[model samples]
Target: MRKGILIFTLISFLLLNTPVLAQEPLNNIDLQPFLKLTMNVTLVNTGEYPKFIAVNPTYDFKTFREGDEYLLHNTTDLIQLSKANLILNKRVGFWIYPHEVLKVEFSINIPMDLGELYLQDYADLCYPDYTITWSTKRITYPPSLGVGPLCEVVYPHLINYPILVDLTSFIQVRDPEIVIYSYSGEVEFTITNRGPKTMFAVALPLIPVDAKIYSITPNPDMNYTEYMGKFLPTYLKSQVQNAKFNLTQESVLFEYTDTLLSTMSSQQNLIQNSITTNEDIVDYPIWIVVLGENSSFDIKYKFQWEFTR
Candidate 1:
């Protein structure tokens, strides 16, 4: 009888201590409509056991600029969990008991140098929609049953929140004034910013080639220039053949030489025609003009083109 009682007690203890499988935790993301860049996230552990939860937040810049890490605020507050762990890749983790709710608040800061293009894109009804993704995982503890999988049992889930941007009170850029000198091929461009907020490091595109550039009114931080070209495979092959061949050719090789020259000439014509027919293949030069807010500056440059009769 005692043996039966002992066996029954052991069975009851095993059944009570066994870990039960549970579904993923419930998570909610909220972005304050009135605030500029504020977000709140709530997480609830619905399981019966304690869970170690980790959250990783990421930004998806759909229309606005990408790879701007400086725009996201790092510091996050975990309201329920008295302790917060700052993990890798802007992740936050904490421990929560059964039926407990955790709240996290995030605040993002907008820099002064966020260019005029972003605002203009938004104003044109081109709404720069941005989304934030929360990657979360919960590991239930009280350690799984014996000889089970060594890895922790984790339930993973993802939550997405769309960010709202209001640029009505943002800085405004006025139309620029341009002057051209026909004789010297020199041009002057003036830009003005009328603003309630200060702007910095604004970039304006200049469409000209082989230009002599200067910043006249307020000196710019830096000037950036780049030249892009498209080279055809046939042109490259002709160049290689020309480089490999010698000027002195024996009579036996003369016929072959004439054919090679004819081929090269045909290839050159093909390359020229290809360039002329495709507008996208033409070489382009990019120049960036940097400016400040509530201010004006003049940019002077000389560029010329020649025509054949």
Candidate 2:
């Protein structure tokens, strides 16, 4: 029994000293740099196996754009994400086997008809068995967990601030067409703040751009000092080029939200704000400008009209 115990101890020591891997463990799990994707191509085998997509999965590159540049997005759904959001899910594959090297050989028809080329990637370090190596050997997986999966954007320039603000209706020129009619009607506005955070109150507006000449005369919505509760210099109506509404101090009111808010929760806050109406009754106008597709058809903001002429 003593001899058997001694043999067991010796074997345990040898096992502990045994090398687990031939080299080192690669820890980086992101796949952006090593990710090479191709669209539109014909297959040609190099010799036996010139290239092998390591994860042991079969993929067809034949359906890709043969010579044209194809844009790559990081989603499996293949849809675009907002410019504000940059992170993408993993979209890379690798082969397994700790020591065996497999290769897939194929000939590709590289025609000049293709435009620019770009690629997006991610690595899977969940299992240490997966590995991908290229001839240049420039790309690598970092040996740490917290290392960034360095994201990149590549494509033609396009839209900005893309968001779906939903459908809303406005009654155009209630009193009268200031330029054409004798009377205009009032378009009562009640803006609702659906956000948990206090909807940031800005100067005249939280608009995409500011007006140069701005407001001139105080009409219906253009009454900068009256409609807009705060006397901010940046108020667009204050500089207005003005409308024709006879101003009244008591006619204005302060509302935190819209009058008939459909999809917001701040109805109570705005209702409360309306109660103490002596000083802050005045609120900013909902200024908007409509233009035709033609660049020549541009106009300054048109405020809601009540009546004055």
RMSD of 2: 31.8
Which 10-residue window in model 2 sums to the lowest lDDT?
Answer: 159-168
Model 1 lDDT on a 0 to 1 scale: 0.25
Give the alpha-carbon lDDT of every model.
0.25, 0.22
Superposed Cα deviation of residue 109, candidate 1 (Å): 1.9
Q: TM-score of every model?
A: 0.20, 0.14
lDDT, candidate 1, at 130: 29
lDDT of 1 by residue, 1-309 (tens): 432333344333322321221221111211111101233334445567765444323211111112222123223322222222333344444444576554434332222111211212111111123222323333233332344345322111111111111111111112111111111123343334432222222232222221212222233332211111112113222222211222221101100121111111322331111111111212211222332434544443332222223
State the lDDT at 57 in candidate 2.
Answer: 16
Candidate 2 on 60-99: residue-level lDDT in tens? 1111222321122333235332222122234322221233
Give the C-alpha miss distance for residue 92 in model 2, angstroms: 75
TM-score of 1: 0.20
